[model samples]
Target chain A: MSVLVYAENADGKFKKSVFEAVSYARAIADQNNTTLTAISIGNVAADELSALGQYGAHKILNVSTDKLKNFINQAYASVIAKASEAEQADVVVISNTFSGRGLAPRVAVKLGAGIADGAVSLPDTGNGKFLIKKTAFSGKAFATVELTSANKVIALIPNSYKVIENATGAKPEDFTVETNESDFKALLKEIVKSTDKVSLPDAEIVVSAGRGLKGPENWGMIEELADLLGAATACSKPVSDAGWRPHSEHVGQTGIAVSPNLYIAIGISGAIQHLAGISSSKVIVVINKDPEAPFYKVADYGIVGDAFEIVPKLIEAVKTYKASA
Target chain B: MNILVCISNVPDTTTKVTFNANNTQFNTAGVQFIINPYDEIALARAIELTDGGKGAVTVIHVGEAANEPTIRKALAIGATDAVRVNAPAHDAYFVAVQIAEYVKQHPFDLILTGRESIDYNGSKVAAMLGELLDIPSVSIIKKLDVDGANGTVEREIEGGKEVLTIPLPFVAGTAEGVAEPKIPNMRGIMSARTKPLTVVEPVEVKASSEIISYETPAPRGQVKLIPADDVAKLVDLLHNEAKVI
Candidate 1:
């Protein structure tokens, strides 16, 4: 009864979310009274791979191959499944990011394992059933899912768990799996990255706006505030629909759902659909002129005034606090 | 090109969620159902891909007769026909197996589904279909273009995007930027009434997972309202009380 975790990385470096996944996997491993082994698929340096041990990885398997440079969902799933077989792993854990969402189901199918995606809580194993709580209806509700299969796969939602460091002296062992032409059929031809801004999914703090901002021209203050706070920028559906912001920046039921640490809404009336997406945030702050806006109902803090008047003052205050601290 | 769009009938976005049956089932006493929003995007792109009588767009669902109206709405939105597997979508694996069994007898060139259903929020069917059928699958693609026997797609990564190409007879989970959903015109609605609505028995497949219970998020407490003029005080509160920044 051993557990395997996929330590996902980008350009050979691990993200904070990856450490969080490892930490969550470590807790599950502890619960099951099993050792945790982490698998890295890309070409990561040994020193960088060893950082996973700080998050409670007992051992590491490094599978470095030129063929696995870019993420191909099918191939990655196949590799993870093969690793599970090699380790005789009864449980597998992956971060429920964009790539993990694509890889987990296929891996489950390959391993004949039951999966619980978007899992927010650790599995309750005391009742002899591995039941886990996960977000459903796009964060509007929660469902407790029971995995009945002998083998199980869990996709942990990013930022759902804290990254706690535990010391270990684990080393990496080279692991390899056979691949064929079928794995490369869906060819990843190019990658386009937006270099300047923080990605919305990984952002701890998000500054968002809505239709009340009026137009795209008035977005300077929003961007300035986001920049000062090192936060990602997001907008409501109407703002994206009217082409004021990119669709990737839209946070709602139909858009990119975010569960950041701090979500700041300026000039945005929280519609039910919009709230369905962001209701999972840890803290919410609303800035709007309308005191009766639905957003204030869910907000932790609110300032009822013109965003134009409030945001600049907020930015100045943040700047002063940062300098003084 | 023949395209199949898999849709899920879900509770409307504004429905207040509740549970009954010992908190094990969703209470549907007053809930209204609609085509899942992401699936609508998949259907719209299928219709666009097969426009001008180039091919057929068949919409499918795994549910009982209670969901026929929701499936019919897809037909009204430009799907050529519809299919409803006469069984509850027990789970992602069960639903995927049923669809794969039906498609085994009747195959399509391209298959599309939403990134996930709003109800289960399981983005599993597309990948499961790909694995079961031994074909390539891409999830959450923003853009798709088909030319001859090849398809190009742009899929979102964590902080960026990746462009990939796959052959025909592939499965893709469509996302928001794929296409704009089309509203049913009066004529389309009239025609949808006469379109074929086929009901088929589901194949036997064991569910790998079961829902043990349902829970609603805790209601948020009162908001600490700050004076518009007291920006510094708000900052102090954020720094001390909230500790988010």
Candidate 2:
């Protein structure tokens, strides 16, 4: 059973997270005594395609279709079913990004496969049983799920797996995928970027603030710190609701959940809703005037102080450290 | 403009999660169940789309009798009727098949669901339903407008948002900022009791996946309290010890 990994690309470039998924698929393929194949849609250079070989893909199949460019879910899922058929793949690995969340299940249904989403680690294949660990209860808990289906689809949670980049280069093949006029029916008219700043999903560090910052006007220091640290800026629900930040920046139960390596919470009380989003974060740093803020409870480090004063000092420290380095 | 909103019954966000014997079943002893928060936004949007009694908004839940209260809550919030598929929602594939089968019989011009249930966080059913129904499906949508048979939507993509237009007989998984939830008023709550709550047997579909066990996350370690004024120390720790910077 050959394994297939869907490496996602944006603006004709492969995302770093996609390689992580390919690396994961690589290990699974080797353990099963089978070679893995990587399928990328739209466009990428021949070198970029062969770069996936470092993650141990035996071949790279590029479905260079103009119709497949804008991420129409139905259209994209169709490409996957066709590729899986050609590759004789029994397992499909995908990065659990925004597109993965939209694309994986549809592919599973088309292939009659049992799908697992938000997988935190590689599957355990031993004693004639395959078990996958996935974050359940919104990140509150993890569930060991067993896919009984022969054709299985797994979307690896981003940042959980590290990509390996030392392997033989895979041969790149341009495969033609058939599409009907209806494939382009649901079109993406335009894309409006939220910011040129680091995207939230892939950001290693995130600087987030809440109502404690008072008003939108007070975001100066928060933005300054995020810019200095090269981190994405996020907000609590109330802050976004009040238009102090875009709703896209809201990280909580009702917003975009994040799992960065380092998540710095400034002037935000950690409600359960907010906590659920970042519980997976490797390290949490919280700054709040109220020492009893619930966020401090889950934080690895805490400072009881005003964010306005603290953030500026932190920004200066980060600036100096960067300059010295 | 007939609209169908898919609702999921999940534990409240604040519920302290626990497992039963061998972690096979979720111990639902005292845990309160509410309409999944994301689904609430979709339900609210569905109600507004069918406002002024222009059309009907039907709520569908794929769970056992235990979800009756949550289904009723949807009716109270302003759905015309409710349907309960008699079965446990084992996985997204199972739930989507049941809803797809049910909806094909009682079709609606538009369908809505939360981006994903907060519990499972699968974010699958909507697209599966769209595929099953062969209609356009949009995810993470924050705005939708239906004029005549055409629909316009704005959905969040990776680093940005996109606008798209699709015809009627479509499915959409909504996110927050779509609409404020309608807390059932006294009249609506009273009327919800009289509103129809139909229980239907689930369509037989094999689950592709099964849960072997469940585990809560590891507990947080002791927090290292840094002095309020020690900015350099924190930066030093991040770079040298934590190595995050």
Candidate 3:
């Protein structure tokens, strides 16, 4: 029996989220007394693939499909399923990323394994049962779910598990998996970006604006502050709908949900849907002209003022601090 | 063309979530319900794609009968009709099975749903249903364009967006920006009252997962209210207390 993980790669490097999943699988394998193996797609460098051993993976199964360079959910899921069979994996772990979110459930169906997403913890095997804690109701509450199926899948949310590097020097083994040509139906054709700034989902710090910012033309200060702080720029749903920001940068219950390390909300009233997505953030800071804005209720820090006036000073302060240090 | 949109009835965004003593069930009393915001996006897109007239845009829900009002709201928002699969939403697998079984006979050219339900955040059914139906599935789509049997979809990725060509009879779990969710106007609500609502029994399927219990997260510490003029102190605190920089 083996604990299998799908190590996701981007720009020819394993992402932090991938390492977190491998670290998670490492602990799971140790507890279950099983070897932990990982599968990755495309022509990832052997050294890069082997680097995963630092996270306790015993072997790295490499599927070198050129077309796998793009994020094709179906093809990736198919390869992961085939790799599971090759490794005889009992527990499959993946990070709850964009690709992981689309791919994990398909893998579960293909492997006939019970699956859980947004997992926040390692499985508890005490009492001879497998239970895992996962976010429920969009982070408002938590639920412990029991997977009764012999085989199981867990998709850990990004940043939920801390990565511990243990240099085991795991070697890479080439594996072959055939993906049906028809499985490429929903393939990525092209990638487009509105800004070169750090994307919200991958960002550790996010500086977001809202309708109270007044209009899109006044976003220079917001962008300046985010750039000074090395943070991504985001907006509330209304800001996106009103064309103040691109829809890709919106974070709410309906929009992209984020769990950044530090989320600074400027001029936002903190709608419940908006708060749901960011409730898991490590630390929240709110700046609003209205003292009664709901965002301050959940914020770790609050500043009640006009963002137009306060943001520039904050940016200057950050610049001064950086210059001194 | 028949487009099937899956809608979920969830507690309104403002509702405070709580649980029973054993945490076996959600404490839903006194809470209002609405069509999931993301699902409303899917439903609105389906209506837009169907031109609001010719082809049918049908919304379906797998839930207790009490969710019919939510279905009616979907119809009022411009779905041609709706189907209520009378079953407890036990798990993603069970719900997917019911949808697969229902759609196998009905045969829709397109299936749409929110990326994930607001309550469970499972995000499982679309792909599972796609697998069970032997069709393709896509997620995180921000735009979908359909012409005849061919369709193009744009989805957000980590740092950018990817456009894809998805064929017909495929499942797509939509994100926001697919379309602005439509609220029911007076005429639409009047028309929705007469829209056909089909009821079907769920197929026998066992839940692969079960919820053990629920728990609330620990309360956050009090916020450190900083004066607006104290930019230096705010930065100092961020470096010292929050250490976010």
* Top candidate, metric lDDT: 1
How many residue pairs clash (N, CA or C atoms closer than 3 angstroms) in each of the candidate models, in the order given?
0, 0, 0
Quote each prediction's TM-score.
0.99, 0.98, 0.97
For candidate 3, the per-residue lDDT at A62 reads: 86
Candidate 2 interface RMSD, angstroms, 1 decimal:
1.2
Encode model 3's per-residue lDDT on A126-152: one tens digit a residue: 999999999988888889999999889
Each model's lDDT? 0.91, 0.88, 0.88
User: Which 10 successive residues of model 1 chain A have the least lDDT summed?
Assistant: A188-197
Look at candidate 1 and tell me the lDDT of residue B25.
88
Number of the top-ranking candidate, with DockQ as the measure: 1
- Give lDDT for model 1: 0.91
Error of 2 at A81 (Å): 0.8
lDDT of 1 at B66: 86
lDDT of 2 at A235: 95
Q: What is every candidate's alpha-carbon RMSD to the true fold?
A: 1.0, 1.2, 1.6
Question: Which parts of model 1 are misplaced by more than 4 Å?
Answer: none
- Please, what are the lDDT tens digits per residue for candidate 2 over residues B1-245? 89999999999988877899899878889999999998999999988888897899999999989789999899999999999999989888888999999998999999999999898888999988987887778878888888898888898877888888888888899897788878999989899999998889988898789999999889899788899778888998888988998
Comparing 1 with 2 on DockQ, the higher-scoring candidate is 1
Q: Can you tell me which runs of candidate 2 are displaced by over 4 Å?
A: none
Local error of candidate 2 at residue A76 (angstroms): 0.9
Candidate 3 segments exceeding 4 Å error: none
